[model samples]
Target: MEMLYAKWLFNGKEILKGLGCVSHNNMVVDLLPIKLAKKTYPEAVVKDYGEGVLFSGFVNAHTHLDLSNVSIEPYLGFVKWLKTMIETKVQANETQTDEAIKKALDSLIKSGVCAVADISNTLKSCNYLKKIPKAIVFFENYSLRKKQAQEKIAYIENNIENIRQTYKMKIDVTAHSVYSTHRDLLGYTMLKNNPKFGSDLFSFHFLESEFENPFVNSRGDLFEMLQEKGLIDNQLHFSSAIEYIKSLGDIKKGLFVHCVHIKPDEIEYLKSIDASIVIAPRSNYYISKSLPNLELLKNSGINVAIGTDSLASNWDLNIINELKFLYKHYSHIDPAYFFGIATTGGYTALNLHIGFKKGFYAYPFFMETTTNNALEEILQ
Candidate 1:
């Protein structure tokens, strides 16, 4: 048995001082006051970590590991960056892609990420994710043409079925985004994955860019791409992406990624549905040069989580760096709050329990610093 004490301790909920944790066999047995821990575990070895914060390992709620090899810089715009990413993937051979994924996984582990909610356009990452301690692999789907919705759905279903039969792993099929996936395809996927069908958790990219609004209303470059294929009608007028998605069915249990343009009313609706909002601030700024209103999200009492997005649009796959970026920009919000978003909020989003409790794996992360500002020190 061992007792570890730190100046500050986050028990996956709140930060407390003069507290410590006791663990054995990689499991956290209890969290108690430092003095009490010393008394209760008198024979146990004590490691007093001075002047830093110790907390649960990070849970990266969203990422695209397959796109790890794409360039992080040279982003002209959201659409252009996306095109470049697609082109890069098309040109990358299997060996390069595998190497990129392996490198990304190594970086994540070194950065102390204990759980991941990874989005994959291909099944190649599955072989590596199975070796991780905790991960939710989301098979991505994209179909812009309405006529191809059924075909895409059939293909995705078959792919998911084959994945289950071959790897025997729990994989979730999710829509790429509102603009990339046809409404019919989203509805079909949600219906098929509903409890009556398979009870699989649904995930979708919400409004991650301002271009999404014009595309959904049939007027932007994205819409023009679809128009070239004769997919959408020029006369059609659609509401906000949130409304269109709600019009289809219940998305309360689903995971909504990015949400950079989510409105106030939409926040309430999302909260009502018990949906999770994943904020990729760095990726948002990297692609669109904009970020979601962090103040608005915090005031809405919604469950918000942080994600590093992908190396294609981010500097690295480190969740700590994402938190540091947020802290540096949104200095008003308490670092402890962001800490919750990085740890508990992420686990909650993925529906995984990784709190520091008895029988739970004690995936603790520590940082050494002179300042009591946990977030600032971690960033440094």
Candidate 2:
């Protein structure tokens, strides 16, 4: 047994002073005061991390680890970046891809991310995501034709059980987005959601740009771009991404990434479904030159989580960097609250099992403080 005490502790809900956590073999058993921790676990070794904060590590609610191998410098042009990203993914060799995955995960882990809800296109990162304490790899399926979609479904139907058993990991099939995936594909994959992992625990890249909604609604620059590339036809259209998702099936109950163009009612709809929004503010600014209405998201009382997105758009996969960005952007809000988004808010958003049984925050860390607020100071 080991005892870890710091100036402050985050117990998956709120930060409190004068507390410590006791654990055995990497699993947290109890969170108590220093005296009680010593009394309860008399045989344990105590590590006094003085004048610092100790809590379970950050939970990255959304990221694309597969994109670790790809870095399309942001704001050159969203379309050009998109094309370059696709082209790079296609051209990269297997060894380089694997190495990049390892490098990216090492950086994330070093930066204190214990859990991740990752969006995967190739599912290459799934093999390595298990390295983290908690990982949910959402394998994105995209197909316009029902036949093609069925084939992908059949592949998962046949292999998912073994994959789960072999990998000892949680993975679910998800639609890429309203614009990229067919309704049949979306409906089919969504219906196959894992109830064990929360039936609505899916992530979609929704309304990250101004062009997204207009294209989903059938008239925009993106629509024109897809048309020019012969990628989409006049098959389906909806008033909004939310409507399009509703048209396909029931409202999902997990993190929705981006949401730069989300509306007031749409935010309420997310609340109605008990969903969380995973904001990658840095990545959003890169693609759309605007951040999500953080003021509105905060006041809306929705569970807001944080992510760095993939390195393809953002600079790093570090969750701390994400917190710092949010802090700088919304200095009005308490920085400690942003701290919760990276930790408690993220774990709750993903519906991760907490406490001794399983959870990432169950594994805590100690970071020496340098400012008034140890929590915010750790980020600095």
Model number with the top TM-score: 2
RMSD of each: 2.6, 2.5
Write one digit per residue (lDDT tens) for candidate 1, span 268-360. Answer: 998887888999998988886888788999999899988888887888888888888888888877777888898888888877767677767
Whole-structure CA lDDT of model 1: 0.78
Q: Which stretches of candidate 2 lie over 4 Å from their true place?
A: 145-147, 191-200, 355-361
Model 1 regions lying over 4 Å from their true place:
42-47, 156-162, 191-193, 196-198, 229-236
What Cα-based lDDT does every candidate model obtain?
A: 0.78, 0.76
Candidate 2 differs from the real structure by a C-alpha RMSD in angstroms, to one decimal, of 2.5
The per-residue C-alpha lDDT of model 2 at residue 248 equals 59
The 10-residue segment of model 2 with minimum total lDDT is: 352-361
Query: What is model 1's C-alpha RMSD?
Result: 2.6
- The true-versus-predicted C-alpha distance at residue 294 of model 1, in Å, is 0.6
Model 2, residue 50: displacement in angstroms?
1.4
